[model samples]
Target: MFYAVSAVVLGFLLDLALGDPHWLPHPVRLIGWLIARLEQLIRPVLPKTPRGELLGGILLTLIVVGLSGGVSWCMLHFAAVYLGKLPAYLLEVVMCYQLIAVRSLKAESMRVYRELQKGDLASARIAVSMIVGRDTEKLSPAGVAKAAVETVAENTSDGVAAPLFYLLIGGAPLGFCYKAINTLDSMIGYRNEQYLSFGKFAAKLDDAVNFIPARLCALLMIAAAFFTGLDGPGAFRIWKCDRKNHKSPNSAQTEAACAGALGVQLAGNAFYGGVLFEKPTIGDARRMVIPNDIRLANRLMVVTSLLSLAAFSLMKLLIIFLLH
Candidate 1:
């Protein structure tokens, strides 16, 4: 239990300092590669019918998640049995670090901020495109900034808090399970003609796993807003009012808090693959979204991540104490 707690802390610090350097290989990317390979192998064997595709998706999920969690568990177990606790702890720390993307989220969003600061709307659009799923070709300067902020807000829950929640609950193995689900969803979970039936389980499972952490992260974000002098009451009010603004049950939780805290509207509509998705607007358009809002949203995300770590760590420790 102590090692679990310490791994989370040190992993978080490592992520903050290193922020996913491109030189190092990431397990998540390996997971993604594995998913693609499995999909290629699985799809060819299944029928083209909806039920067949659905069954294929289920098998894919089971294999990917099982392998991810099982491999991590084996690695740690073998390391502890043969090498030492310190080596096992170090492997666990790296595993925990790979599971979360707090610093990477910030660094990616800030590229847009830096581009916008230079008055390079074109460059800003390109930078924002890397992070956002929407079509960025036709976005204006404000649109670029809004997209960046919205990505930061939504990812606060998905990329940071949700992983931390799992890490605290079940250590690195369970955390990898969560990431496998999340990565599968990102890779295949879509309402498009190709994925509608094929990715249903992954999509639903992602929603299920993220439900609690998303709301918890929003609450932490509200408190972070208050502490950072953004707009605590407004955040709470908007969260209460607009938490369900997205088609996704979990995506809007943090977006609403962030929009209200920053005093700008977000998530009205977005073009994806040239098709416009009409999404409900969250928060009132109290002010125009600016490039600086990206920085503020990052601030909120960082603070919320710290609060989640501290709170979940304490919860984990308390549970351990009770168990002992």
Candidate 2:
């Protein structure tokens, strides 16, 4: 229990100090590669019918999640038995670090902020394009900033909170499995003609897994806003009013909270694949989204991530004590 708790604390420190080094191997990317290849093989075997697609997606989820958990457990088991518990525990720390993404998400958001601050809208569009699914070519400065802020808010739930929730409950393997579901959703979970049927299962699975974590993320972000001197009351109010603005069950929860906290409107019509998508707007437009709001959103996200780390670690210790 001591090593497990230690690994949790040290893992949070590692993520903040060294947000995914470009050189290090990431399990999420590896999971993505596997998903892509598996999709290629499996999609062809199934008919284009919904039943076929559903079964194929179900099989894909089982394979990817089972493989991720089994591999993690086996690796730890072997290391503990062969080397020692200490080495195995340290390996666990590294896995936890790799699994949770707080600082890396903030770094990417700040990259867009830097480009926007330089008065380089084109470059900012390029940077924002890295994080958002919408078309960035014709976005205004405010649009770019809005895109960045929205991505930060959405990822706050999907990337940081969801992973930490899983890690605290079941450690590295479970966290990795959650990442696999997220990766699958990101890659193919869409309403497009090609993915509408094939990606249904993945999208629903992601929604189901994130159902609780997403709401928890909103509450945490609101608390973080309170401590960070943002508009906590506005966040709560807007979150309550517009939390269901997005089409996804979970996407809008944090986005509404964030837009309210920052006093800006988000999610109007946006171009995707050259087609205009008129998304439901969230939060009253008390102010236009600016590049500075990107920094503010990052501050909120950072604080939320820190609080999540501390809160979940304490929860882990409690669970451990209760068990023993």
Candidate 3:
């Protein structure tokens, strides 16, 4: 537990000191490649029947879970010994911070803001495209801002809270395993025809694992909003009202609170590959979204993350004291 907590803190500081480097190998990317390779190996052997698909999927899910868990345990154990306790702890902290995308999220959102500030709509559209799945080519400034804010809000839970929750519950090995599963889901767990069956288990497992963490993320965002002097009542109200707007039952809860806290509406008709997805709007639509909203959201995310860390640290200390 000490090593796990230390790694999270150190990893976060390292991320702050050095944003993602292009040259370094990302563990998530490595895990994703492994998942792809395993899927390919299984594909050739499976029969072309629904029953076969179901059986293959169950086997694949078990393989993925076991392999990921085993790998994480080995890596953590090696790190603890080879890296030395203090350095390993620091590395773990940095690793944990890497799991959260708060800084990257802010950077991507700011890129759009910078383009918009220069009055370069074309460039702003392109920049926004990097971060959101929605059609950005036709977005107005408000639309772009809305997209940035909404993405940040939703990912705050997926990219931060969920990982942290797992880390607190089961330490570094479990945390890394969760991140591995999340990476696999992101890479292959699409509803598209190609991945629908192949990635079914990954997607469903990801959803199941994230259920509790997502709600906890919403609560943390609400608390952070109140701490930051935002409209707490409005945040709660909109969160309750729009919690079911998203396709994922959990994502909407956090995004809705963030939208309301920032006093901007989020969601509407979004297009992906020219297909339109009409989603319910969250929060009031009266307030206009601006670049500053991204900054505010980032601020809130940082505060919420810090609070979570403090709470977890205290819990760990209490456990130690009791055990001793």
Q: Give per-residue CA lDDT, model 3, range 1-324, as digits (tens).
A: 455566666665666667666687777677777777887888779986656665666677677767777876777678778887766565556556666666777788888888878888889899989987778888888888788888888888888778777777676667777887777677767777667777788788888898988887888888889999887888898988888887776878888989888888888788877888777788888778987887787877777766666666677667877888
TM-scores, one per candidate: 0.99, 0.97, 0.90
TM-score-wise, the better of 2 and 3 is 2
| Model 1 spans with C-alpha error above 4 angstroms | none
lDDT of 1: 0.95
- Tens digit of per-residue lDDT, candidate 2, span 1-324: 667767867887899999998898888889999988998999999988988988888888789888888898888899999999888999999988988778888898899999989999899999999999999999999999999999999999888888888888887788888888899899889999888877888899999999999998899999998999999999999999999998899999999999989999988899999999888999998877999999999999989888877777788889889999
* True lDDT of residue 128, candidate 1: 96
After TM-score superposition, what is the CA distance of residue 174 in candidate 2 from its true location, in Å? 0.6
Ranking by TM-score: 1, 2, 3
In Å, residue 313's CA in model 1 sits off its true spot by 0.5
Better of 2 and 3 by lDDT: 2
Per-candidate clashes, comma-separated: 0, 0, 10
Q: Write the per-residue lDDT of candidate 1 for residues 190-231, one digit (tens) a residue.
A: 999999989999999999999999999999999999989999
TM-score-best of 1 and 3: 1
- lDDT of all the models against the reference? 0.95, 0.89, 0.77
Q: Which model scores highest in TM-score? A: 1
lDDT (0-100) at residue 165 of candidate 2? 85
Shift in Å, residue 30, candidate 3:
1.0
Predicted structure with the largest lDDT when compared to the true one: 1
